[model samples]
Target: MKKTAVKKTASRRPRARLKKSPLPFVDPAGQNGLNPEPPRAIFLEQPAVYPGTAPKAPGFELPPDYGDTKIALFAKDPWWLYAYWEVAEPDKAREAIRGLGLAVQRTVLRVYELATDSRAAERVSFFDILVGSTTGDWFIDVGQPDKCWMTELGFVADNGRFFALVGSEAVRTPRFGVSDVVDEEWSFSSELFWKIYRASGRIGAGASSYDVRAVVIESWQESAALQKKQLLLKGEGPSSFQSRGSA
Candidate 1:
């Protein structure tokens, strides 16, 4: 009994570690302290900012600067707009030109529903109008758009003269199924743009898609900027683009 001594051993304990939850972003149940879960912020909770009236479009008569006016944005979020009145005629045409551009400008200033489907029918909540003269290049926008939608309807001359436009800002998340960030350029070639344009019909009534030039569209793994830059240099549409001449 004196020759052998009892050996002592330490008790083992479990270590604390955080693991990925099956429900995503949720902590495992019944762990340590019971902290209440934080609530999510809702964007739709805010009241929409829209005027009660819709600005009227000019009739079939085409003004002198109908398609030639230049719109320059001198500020961010673009508040101050400088409209260059380069009318071809004397006084009356200039007045009509100013009036027409002003009306279009007012409409563009306010956020309009650029989606064709009834607001309730579609999942989309809201949209803003981006009139042609509102941006730098005389199109919707010349750079990559963060979020947006387009509609089949647009502002125009009563004689069927068309005015270019884009829709309001969209909510951002990893949610858009067909959109790639870097693959987006100022032009509409991305799947996101096509889908929105196709559904919304940003094109004016009865206009042909044949006049719409294609831009190099990059897929999920492609570079949108590079493709657009290349298209800009080449003055050609994408490889898959087909001319919708009659259809």
Candidate 2:
């Protein structure tokens, strides 16, 4: 009897996976008090904006659907106005900010577009670096930060220990658009957001509170001598020495 060889057949259909969008209603520690993660901007709701509240984008900026239910924030510093939408269906809330590459801007942050990916962590790093540099200073020049972080960068604490931290998190939308190709007409509907901040900079990561505080204060100032000026203070007004001269 002759032996016959059997052949294997492949299926016509491909593997199916869930189409997941970045978390909908994301509130980084900066503003929206909900999520309270780091990179959260200082968001304070202004008085009833009423009819003149947030302006509408001709095509996508201000959609009529946004409704008056929304109030203007960052009145004094209306920089990053995070937008969110809630769908009563399966009880889901989404951040409609990323779907549209509507271009984020701030008065002082006009120097650079931050033209790369921006999520919570980068924001955290940006803030961390900012606060860590501006301690006790007025104005500072800011720039778009590079996140490829390598070479073991860190801060030196009073104890003479070099403190370094490594952070990781989901990437922000648009900048990468890894999920989908960016379309011109941007809206909150397809917006995608993620948690971002200095991951390992906290106490749990071996960094001291003093170092963290120093970084935070210095971050507010963005100058060339940022760290040098902030970290190394003048030193208690030049330690005076009271000694009698030898005769």
Candidate 3:
């Protein structure tokens, strides 16, 4: 019969749970709390500035009309002329019609071909182009080169008479071929002429110097023969005189 000693244990109690914060916790070194690594950045070279840098150009816009009543003609090429015109306000047109005492029926562009450069010279020929009311520009096909031309913007009256509003200065179209002003005649030596001919590929690149010499000799002989033939045809040849002397 022995008495046993028993140990008493304390009752278990539930612990209180802590609420989570919505904001992220930051470290004193200004780094993310979850990822404690420092932030990284890439550096780039600074740009250079030049002393001759130009300022930005201002925006430019062309007005529809210059508010002046004028017609200008320009020669685009040997056979074409461009004409542009601007009519003043409607009141100006009415005033012009009243001053001329004519009722305008339609607009017209009259093209004139001057015979000479003299201001008092008459027009050799003229043609009319029927341009509508809304036309501001036109391309005229002159079909002739090296000619002086003039144009007038006008209106055909109801009575079939024409009234001019504005006239452009006469412009001369250029010729397509070589200029007529010849200062002097250019003559080249036979050796120089042959060199140019060879350079121009008339003589083949694969030809030897002897071949070039033969070609030049043949060309000279042919030219002399041609000159003799021409003299014989004209009845004034050395061959005819030699034959007469032989006879």
Off by over 4 Å in 3: 1-61, 99-101, 118-120, 179-181, 185-193, 200-247
Native-to-model Cα distance after best TM-score fit, residue 211 in candidate 3, in Å: 20
What lDDT is reached at residue 142 by model 1?
17
Q: Ranking under lDDT, best-scoring first?
A: 3, 1, 2
lDDT of 1 by residue, 154-187 (tens): 3444443434333223221122245565533444
Q: Model 2, 181: alpha-carbon shift in Å?
A: 4.4
Better of 2 and 3 by lDDT: 3
Give the count of colliding residue pairs in each prediction: 9, 31, 0
**lDDT per model vs. reference:** 0.38, 0.31, 0.80
- Worst 10-residue lDDT window for candidate 3 reads 182-191
Candidate that would win on lDDT:
3
Q: Compared with the true structure, what per-residue lDDT tens digits does model 2 show for residues 141-214?
A: 22222222111123333343333322222222222224455663332221121111232253235555665565
lDDT per residue (tens digit) for residues 108-216 in model 3: 8999999876435689999999987523899999989999999988878878887778888888888999888755324336775777578556776755667668776
